[model samples]
Target: MSRQGRPQDTRKVSGELFSLTYGALVAQLVRDYEKDEEVNQQLDKMGYNIGVRLIEDFFARSQQGRCHDFAQAADVLTKVGFKMFLGVVPTVANWSAKGDEFSLILDQNPLVDFVELPETHQGLLYSNIICGVIRGALEMVQLEVKVWFVQDQLRGSDSTEIRVKFLKKLEDAVPAGED
Candidate 1:
């Protein structure tokens, strides 16, 4: 009979494998797109799709409950979400006067650990997918936000920073066939 004591734990992969695979993917995208802006947009789009689905999994696995405000969401994103998924927890800082914007600081980025952006891809945002992911996740919860990477160590920045701006809350719209 199968072991029935404790349930199977979550799957984990080596950081090296993850870093290499992700770096290769980005490199290929850059080669195919042939333009920094195009590559960045494509990466963001892909990340948005991932984020849309990832939010559901995050809700189920994390069991953190609903976030009532931006602060709570920020906490969950930096503390629980990043820590669990990436094994690296980002710090949330640089709050705006109106509390509509903040910066998520990554002291260490696994995605860029072995990544080096060539001179040709100078303007390209290598980690743009992260911004898209954050935007997608927040949007899924009705918090329309703008997320973009402002600093990237791959491009010679000391630390990576993602700027998140709270645009506006989305209103639930009824489906056409519902009523």
Candidate 2:
């Protein structure tokens, strides 16, 4: 049983199965959307929804507490979060002098294990969902952040890099009647 008193599936998921499933979803989205930008937005939205829920599971499974700062948050996300979910630990690099921003260099993106972006879909961010996931997860922790794909292997980049910028921490809201 999991910490939440739920049964956990210990079965390991095949990487190929995961990749093919994601590919099919992207393909369907491309067919449904008229523009690549729209597809990217849709994918991000999907990831956001997933992230919102996934964070709860992450905490339950990992037994981690709140992050004290953006730098720590980035470290935990790359070291623990990515490893838990995607089976990859991205290298955190390219920090801004202000320490408000950094980049995650993914050596291998499992989501793109068997993906090849067609020439017509150059503008499409095939892994934009990752950005959304990071943004959504951070938001849940009261950390407002901006995430984007700076470079993509599918887009001919030598490596996959996701850039994250910390915006601000969200303040707790008072109840309407108590304020």
The model with the greatest lDDT is 2
Tens digits of per-residue lDDT, candidate 2, 82-134, equal 99999899999999999999999999889998788999999999999998888
Residue-level lDDT of model 1, residues 45-120, one tens digit each, is 8888888878888988989887888888899999998997898999999999988899999998888767777887
Question: Would you list the C-alpha lDDT of every candidate in the order shown?
Answer: 0.85, 0.87
Q: What lDDT score goes with residue 153 in model 1?
A: 85
**Over 4 Å off, model 1:** 1-10, 173-179
Q: Model 1 has how many clashing residue pairs? A: 0
How much is the lDDT of residue 169 in candidate 1? Answer: 90
| Candidate 2 lDDT trough over 10 residues, lowest sum | 170-179
Cα deviation of 118, candidate 2, in Å: 0.9
Given candidate 2, what's the lDDT at residue 148? Answer: 90
Kindly report which residue pairs in candidate 1 clash with one another.
Answer: none
Error of 1 at 88 (Å): 1.0
- The list of candidate 2 runs beyond 4 A from truth reads 1-9, 173-179
